[model samples]
Target: MEPEQQPNNSVVVVMVPLTAQSHLNKLLQFAKIISSRGVPVYYMGSTMHNRQAKDRVHGWDPSTISNIHFHDCQLQLPQVITPHHDLYFSKMFPLHLLPILIQLREPLSSLLRSLSATARRVVVVHDSLMSFAAEEASLISNVEAYYCFHCVSVFALLYLQWEAFGKPIDQGLQGGDIIPRDLPRVSFEGCFPEDFSEYAAQNIQWSMLDVGNIYNSCYAIEGRFLDLMAQHQSDKMLWAIGPTNPVAFDSSAGVHHKCLEWLDKQPQSSVVYVSFGTTTSLSDAQIATDGLDICNDEVIKQRFIWVLRDATDGLDICNDEVIKAQLPNGFEERTKRVGMIVREWAPQLQILAHSSTGGFLSHCGWNSCMESLSMGVPIAAWPMHSDQPRNTMLVTEVLKVGLVVLKSLI
Candidate 1:
């Protein structure tokens, strides 16, 4: 591995994500793309997070790429809290991530300075959630920071134009906020709790210091929202560079062939791929809801591949007894011939791109949405929490490529 200090007098780009699985995955892909074009890219995060991102990254390996580097910001994280399955994802954000966010500013500032000292022009791209890093980047004269929004442009526009929608920031929301009356009546409860809104509101100001904003979407997917955002914040530049994951699978990376093999046997456009993103899991009651659908003769006859996160509380536990108990009696045996239940991680991109993948029943996480769209697979949107409902709106309401499976899981 090369040392952190690169040769002097050259332009460099620094990538800083929120250090979550989804956020790190997207930023690493962006870094790879930037490095392929001859720009030296540094992916900055904690040692554990950096390892997790690199180890799980699909498509390309960063080790073989010369210009792409990993810089560890050595900050001791507190013992993280395990989230409860019954609570929505947004409700647990402060408990799990707030400590890490609080401690990152010092290390991030120092790293930005060290990198800036050696490079002629330093471009730092940090997640919108990590506005503190962008604040630090603004302090250095040679450094330019851009906010990479993890959610779709539409999700942002709703909050950015909250006042325009007749909801003043001072009043705050009752339960949580809702979309403008003209748009579909979707709520931010999926990602925003009322208690956390004030904190998020405060950090949004730091984003004003950034040079511009970036999205993991194209004008085609969010053209109107992107245009509206540009007009709303005309002072800053906007770039819609997205579908950052590899367009095609790289087999040499040791792709998971079981999912692909099952898809090959199904007729073209005959299968429905079902998976919620990593963190979101269904409760036992919800599992029974799925069993009812599977029991329907019309549905049971069709080929289906479902990734069931057997972990009850999003822990590492994979209890087969718990999984079987949640399902309807004979659910597994009845569908054994036509259905495949994946108890572990299934290769998503390869499944979405397969000829037999006609639809995706997804949580509408931005990464999954982009991958499915890029592969021309439609969606059956079932959002869990945190920017997901809004992303679901983008998929169902605006893009017209998918439909809402349910408004609320509860």
Candidate 2:
């Protein structure tokens, strides 16, 4: 049945996601779920980002869902200028996205005030990194703001500990640091850049003012960490509503993705799926590792599908030039039957759900972790940066469902 054409507005939600692909994709899935439940959702972002999110969604078309409205904010920002020197890919991504917070402040506030006139309550669910953009929600009448964390509970717990109590020294944590001795010690070794401290502090301070916090996680895997987080923030409510992406794509919808067709030809439990999320890209040297070039005589025989993203823009699809430049010489021809390389943007859920998919070689991004776990696929956790190192620990140490490929950046 087709949903109603117009919103009646008992309660309205506004989703503000960071412009990164992983963040944008997960939040849109959450918006689709909310709209399906009869709540109207207004997804606000720059024109380019809004188009990217919609174009990149799989299985279903969000445009067909009338309740989910896409609002394109007009911003005259210039094209993102890439740095010539090497900065960690994860940190480099936020350098492009964080400026949007300052630009969005006034526009979001105006939208909230306008929505308040018609709706009884307006809920603003902004990305955890985007708190500064939604700060004005506190001043607007009938508007309530909540921080939506795309990472897991364990990472959040440790990140909050680090933000609250500085990096621990040889002298040990001073003052009232409430870190659990049992958990992995907080380390910024492969985490956020030093300049990001002020932004992290802003998010931490904003979290304190919000009434509730939301995570893309569930109690099944991170129940202990979630409970520990609740103890620390007794005044605020914590909700673990996750596995936000569809567990299974609707077969009845008749969507035929090409990757699934290839997987169908492989034997059960034969293929290892490889993807490193959106923002993390390997250095050229890292991409040339012997294990990746299945042509190497030393590596074990296996069938695999690798999603190699464009090095220039992690979210952009890799063109013929990128694939030709990045892959080892004749690597594609030597392993044609045993391997498949998707340049960018594979239907990850569909691939993970395939019977032939035995394991996932992933970057331990929280959304990737949740999707793999939901599909009963074990991860080979190769963490890159940000909260990924802690998320890697959650997968390998706590859940024991996966093994770590590398603990940190080489």
Candidate 3:
């Protein structure tokens, strides 16, 4: 069902989830902040997460915020995004997508219908993959739309655009005017010279610039896509904020409660915060074949918390015993004096902002980076996969806020 409109409601925001907690958490926080600005915010999503985790993360008992309203809007999703790991991310393409595409029509149709009737002048804010559907909906409903959540940096997007979607500037344009020959193309450590697919080499002309991908953050072009969408809006009060997932400020006590206990036992300014974003896993192959290979050789002289989650059977496999078992010889013994906290869960905001905290070792996930920057902590950016590597580049090269180890363009 679509959200019902109130006459006093000046702004209406619709949020769609991107599979997991990290994604939903950021979106919900942004909604809460916006709603607190005296604008009415209505959140629509079904009972997500297991019972315990849901209660713990969002115990939104009305007293949490003064203005925001939580509504349970159950949106049955496409089979491709169905929550199962195998079904969700098996391959880039499929042979039997006909039936799946047929199934998708219903949800897609329903999505458009709901937005059209209720959210008449809606400003749609969306996440990464959700942008595909949200863009489709906004186009059909003729409402303002913006892509949020995580947008990789200009270098990262250029890298992906060059490797996945376009060719390097060296190759020159095969069918249209090129983007000038002087600008250097981002290096793809994983991409091969002859790796050009049929779609990769195809030309994308300038008239189609508006059809390019949208990112949440970038080294250049802040709010470009959103501004393009809102171009005709001279009199309308319509704009897109961000796909922000904010941690509960009041819950800082609970987060701090757990963090302070950990810090109380350890030395001040010694513990390192390490967390990989949701859906980005570090395989032993990803460890041996690519990223962690470079990170493994780095010298560590301080106490640390290394967040390594294995992507086996869709469960976080980096338990205490599992972590100790997989580590190379002498890693634990050598770091014994320095101390390493190995927990599947940590209060990230509390840990990052703590006075005792020194630096962050991260995958450059947008939310984590934002939290670290807002708290004035320096970052050791080790971006693992996808847009993360891109975000890392801008942080180091453009923002000069962090240190990027290597530019592994995905």
> Candidate 1: misplaced stretches above 4 Å?
1-3, 78-95, 163-182, 189-191, 250-254, 291-299, 310-330
- Per TM-score, the best of the predicted structures is 2
Steric clash count of candidate 1: 2
Per-residue lDDT for 263 in model 2?
A: 91
Residue pairs clashing, model 3 = 25-245, 26-244, 26-245, 151-216
329 in model 1: Cα distance from truth in Å?
A: 6.0
Show the lowest summed lDDT stretch of 10 residues, model 3: 202-211
TM-score of each: 0.85, 0.87, 0.62
lDDT per residue for candidate 3 within 1-410, as digits (tens), equals: 44455443244555544434555566666666667676655554443322212333432433466555555534343333212222322321222222222233344445445545554454545544344444454456444544344433434444455464445545523342122243344555533223222212321221121222333332232343234333322333333333233423453344434445666667667776666655444544444444333333245455665555433211222123323214565655665555553435555766676666778877786667766766677787866544576567556655678896544443
Instruction: Judging by TM-score, tell me the better candidate of 1 and 2.
Output: 2
Candidate 1 per-residue lDDT, tens place, 1-410, comes to 23377678888988878766678888998888899899998888777678777776776677889898898766676543443444544433443555666677787777778878888888888887887767888889888655655544455455545643666533334433333344554335435566556656767877778878888878777776666667656888888888788887654454656878888788999898888776565665776675347433356586788887642222233223443224667777778777788876677888888889899988887889999999999999887766677777777876789998776631
What is the overall TM-score of model 2 with all chains considered together? 0.87
**CA shift at 171, candidate 3, in angstroms?**
13
Error of model 2, residue 207, in angstroms: 2.7
